[model samples]
Target: MSRTETAARVPTLATVLDVIRERVTVSRVELAEATGLTAATITHAIRELIDVGFVHEVGTAASSGGTPRRLLELEPTACYTVGIQLDRFTATGVVVDLAGHIVARSSMAGAQEGEPAEVLRFVADHVNDLLATAAVPKSKVLGVGLATYGPQDRTAGVLLTAQPTASWLEYPLTETLSEALGVPVLIENDATAAAIGEEGLGGARSSFATVYMAGGIGAGVVLGGQPYRGATSNGVELGHISIDAFGPACSCGNRGCVENIAGPTAVVLKANTIPGLADRLRLRGDTVADFERIARAATSGDPDALSILEESAAVLGTATVSLVNLFDVARVVIAGAAFATAGPLYRDAAQAAVDRAAFMRFAHPVVVELSDHVSDAAAIGGAVAVLRRSFEARTARSGAPAGR
Candidate 1:
């Protein structure tokens, strides 16, 4: 959409609401300053928001020899958004509020072998089931957000050729889900969504990158307090980055891709060749379960499992080093389904690699850490995606994140 269209959709009232959501609670004076709006404008916006039950007067703050200032805060229970992550092996979903809290979550096998329409039908049913199970009022639900693997055409909410589903190529996901649920549906690349999730709920201040490892490897970059959605939001393909020219082929038509070398699939494959490792773990075909079992073994001092994890982490670290060089970001978050079971190992290796040899080590050190919600990052991101547009407007007006 064009700038005019965006401005038309997001009015002053919506922007003020975003500021209140971001601040959690703030005085009108603080909202005015943070949102770069006049006091009268703030007052008008809050009046409208309060009338809608989205915002309310929480109490007065201490006054400095003046009238006590009435602080405003979001009525977090006013509405909810559903965030769902469709992974190759599992579908994870969560309900989040304006305050970015996970009110409820549910997960199930993704069944990669199923037909696209059948799988989507299951997804829609699961979404409805979640809301019902959580007892969230239908009237209070705003929209649904989906964070799936790329390369997808985010503008059209269509999935292109990607890891999670081959049958979903050219699928009109948003339209399908919207029709199913009778509300607006937003689709985002899981990597990008995970980055947004971390920014909103994780401890990150604003600028950072999230390296998401799951069914496939990818990344989401946030710069200047906004997600850097490359043309069409299909921009970053971290997992497809070639690490070895003669290495194994990847679905993205690349040689020796990071996904091929460092992903859970690779770890499972490598473990199969390790003496007695596969048989000992009763390794089944389920990649997610395999990863958890192996990660646990490694945690228990199994040398073979530890070796697999080390190899995976080392390769991930090498890729992250390149990302740090290209973006000059001060912090990086390792997130997604892959990291869910083996986070510390990846964090340690990636951090060591960045601290030891990152190009800007002398100027500014990078902080590598695990995601606050490892496997659920993308799903939570889907929930927050519903509210992020307003926050973006606030940032545009104030030239910074609303709460910053």
Candidate 2:
């Protein structure tokens, strides 16, 4: 089909493709049932997908006293996309194929006091290096996805908050990055991206919540197989959830926000009060590094380090109870670099809290688990976001109703 025809069919094609990717290998009958699309529509979408080299018949599945049905699966090498998680202290980039597997990865210093132009340039360079390392040509790349902190405008493709510096506020992030990288650029909230990535990993439950921590803490919720992006796509601010009204003030003009009280920075600050603890753990001034050091020490059975982390975990658990009560999700996923070493402690704490205090504890148990991606969840999610944007246009420009 011509490019114009393909573009016109994007909404339907994307919907069918998403179901196939999620199911891994599915027959047309299953696709139609899963997507609520008619069998003829499924056939047309599959034909287009096959013709474009994005999918292929894998094999046939056993039938229930009927002809064996052909199964289809994504063509992993049909295209590639890049995902970058940009933090204040560190940045991670990953080259992902259509199957959501990371082919190559890279990490480097973050935006840290850098101007928008310089940071975008660095990210562009990093993406190029990643593409070269993966041996994937730029022409095969669909686009780039950026995951970062928010309180901003996604439609404008610029950060609204002056985090790290005032210069970042309202910066033309997508436009500049797109110009430098020669591909479309999309931005997503880090925690939301991580949740999307986790969901894409395939799970028994379609609804869950993700708690993400790196330089800070936040959350994302997926309900009924869709991301619950609130008005403006900045809904789940788990970090800013106030845990104590009379405690220390937070930068977000709140009193004793959970992050301000028990986040990585808070845990590190609490550790600093112990004489010689900083030297003992070789605590760096950087919040992420210091938190990791403390977690490592705790993992090694250091009483002081363990106590500090436990205290922080307890506070976080309290906040998580609130999240459970509000969202009523059956599962919670802990993800991000901060959990690389101490994930279990936080998971156990969250699980215990939910078991003890969740409002729906009588109805069902809320399971808390650590994410498989850990440090790269957001980056991988960013890449998935790009793929979704290209393959799953939720709305068609021609005003046709999108396929479910």
RMSD of each: 3.8, 3.7
- For model 1, the stretches where C-alpha displacement exceeds 4 angstroms are 1-24, 32-48, 162-166, 389-404
lDDT (tens digit, per residue) of candidate 2 on 25-119: 99999999987878887887787678768999988997788899999999999999899999797689999988777899978887888998898
Over 4 Å off, model 2: 1-24, 32-38, 58-68, 392-404
What is the C-alpha RMSD, rounded to one decimal, of candidate 2?
A: 3.7
**TM of each candidate vs. truth:** 0.89, 0.91
* lDDT of each residue in 1-404, candidate 1, tens digit only: 45544443343555566667677889989987886777776776676567657788878998788799998888888888999998777679998876667888888777477777777789989988898887887789888888988778877888777444466788888898889888778888899989888876744645888999877789999885567786778887888889899999776778999989998889999999988899898899788889888998998899999989999999999999999888899999989887776899899999999998899999998999888799899998888777665434543564421221
Please, what is the whole-model Cα lDDT of each candidate in the order they appear?
0.81, 0.86
Model 1 clash pairs are none
